[model samples]
Target: MRFSVMDLKVGDRTGSDVFNWNGLLVVSANTVLNADDIDKLQRHDIDYVDIMLRYDGKSPEEKPAAAIPQENETARTYEEAVGGIKLLFQQMLQEGKISKELVDQSFAPLANHIEQEKDVVSLLLTLNNKDDYTYQHSVQVGMISYYIAKWMGKSEEEAVFVGKAGYLHDIGKSRIDNNLLQKPGRLTADEFSQVKRHTEYGYEMIMKSQLPEPIALVALQHHERLDGSGYPNALRSQDIHPFSKIVAVADIYSAMISNRVYQQKQDLLRVLKELHQLSFGKLDAKITQVFIRHMIPNFIGKKVLLNTGESGIIIMTHPTDFFRPLIQINNQFINLSDHHELEIQEIYMR
Candidate 1:
């Protein structure tokens, strides 16, 4: 039977082989459990395992998993925050307007947790949802923006505010036609123009709602580029607000990794490379560098598929060359920086 790790007793045997989220063998079938084994499983973040059960009317005490307290609490917090955001969007669409109270409510539940999270990028990557892309994208952007703000040494309060701003940045998309928003093909020039208007729509909504000025600016300037290449205002580097710079990095990173109606999710490494390119003249170079340097290292220990069709676990990342990391393929180790021709094709997440 499938059982949460906490449900397994010290002497419990595995009924079936247990694998981790990456499809790696965690525990073999028929292996007896012990305290140490359970501890190891917890360290690997294995939430559940299949256990052999006796047909007799006897069982061990039903205890909770030792790891569940904090990690599961974080998961629950994120779920509640996403649900709140979803409802906030629904209300905005129905009413054709937003309120400061509703915007604050959408961001408040996740504030404390976002402040405490050390590696928000990894957490956000793990929590990414392919379904309900829009709502989840907003939540992920908020969490990521909070991390970037903190990385830039912003105060706790400022980081939280930036996160709230990120959450509401795309609220203007609520006014856009749902069919057009989710079309699974290339948009014509007219449709593209409609999509670009989300910035103005979102900006006006936040401004009218009486929210903080910076939050409204983030909505307005998120699509504005540093090189005068972005949409709407097309403001250059000096014209854009710092808050918008942070959100732009977060928004681009989150959207590239996320599956959209018209596009499949891009590889994380590839997305990071593109961000590096954009950082040169289009994006905030300092902010983008800070994001890539801190966030790329978290990919270590993650399983990945390579361009050569081989799958491996990331072992180490280069300090300067963020894209290529040392990976363990079978019993062999290959440093991607040394093998210039090969590249990471995809990253597997659970």
Candidate 2:
């Protein structure tokens, strides 16, 4: 059976294959799709459906001839893990309590899910609109930290700890004034000052709870840049905690790509450009290199509409500059890196 965009709604019944649509996926009947699934569909030229479609009643017993159990397993793992994270974030925001029981219940499953699937970035991206950016940002930072630890070849225990650190990196923001948090325009100096208090607020919040001191430290130092340009405390490179450094990279990358009230969402290449520009001063050069070299390449294969109103698939990426990747438009290789006249104006993920 074929479905159109009109047939899908926020809560509608969908088949397992409902997510296979070529554009604008409507919510599945009951199953929630994640950012990874959305990214996969976009990479394959499918659009609209950003997450999994949930179905009602009994699940279909009939399976596709080409069904890959591994993919389904991975998808389910991500859904459960992300769902738990969302619940915890909401609970914390409302109740202002980090229950040890909740942490204990979710940690193993999330850790296992990460271990089973090596791609944490995809998982985080798939969770894009699962909730507000504040909550999702926390999860994304956690996932990114998990991946960074793994990429750096850290042990599983260390990786999980790092992930936990990321999960709480912005817990301080919870105490900030809502007006400041959700302001759509440029923040006044006083508003900005209020916003900056999140780090300290988060540190105090975590310290009051059962969370370890290291986790609190990570949250406190997340804003502290390598060159001592950060806030609360202008700790330099060597002074910043390693976990905090990891969270800083993840936080910045996620924030850049995320759609915000004052700032439009940036393409992967543009985000990487910003990271590369800030590498020495604001971010760690070595980690930024790894992120650009290994992480950013995955999103390049999809088709994108340039700011110039031209469209094409990303054909090649420059080693030093990601924003100038070559695009294959109408069978022509447009080398954006070498041609200063041409730049990707914007990315329209198909």
Per candidate, the number of residue pairs that clash is 1, 25
lDDT of each residue in 131-247, candidate 2, tens digit only: 477766776777777877866768889988888788778877767777788889999998898898888877777777768888888989999998899988999999988888888
Residue-level lDDT tens digits of model 1 in 218-301? 989999899999978889999999999999999999999999998888888789899999999999999998887666655667
Give me the candidate number with maximum TM-score. 1
TM-score of 1: 0.78
Worst 10 residues of 2 by lDDT: 19-28
All models, RMSD in angstroms: 10.3, 10.7
lDDT (Cα) of model 1: 0.78
Against the true structure, candidate 2 reaches a TM-score of 0.73
Task: Score each candidate by Cα lDDT.
Answer: 0.78, 0.66
Worst 10 residues of 1 by lDDT: 59-68
Off by over 4 Å in 1: 1-68
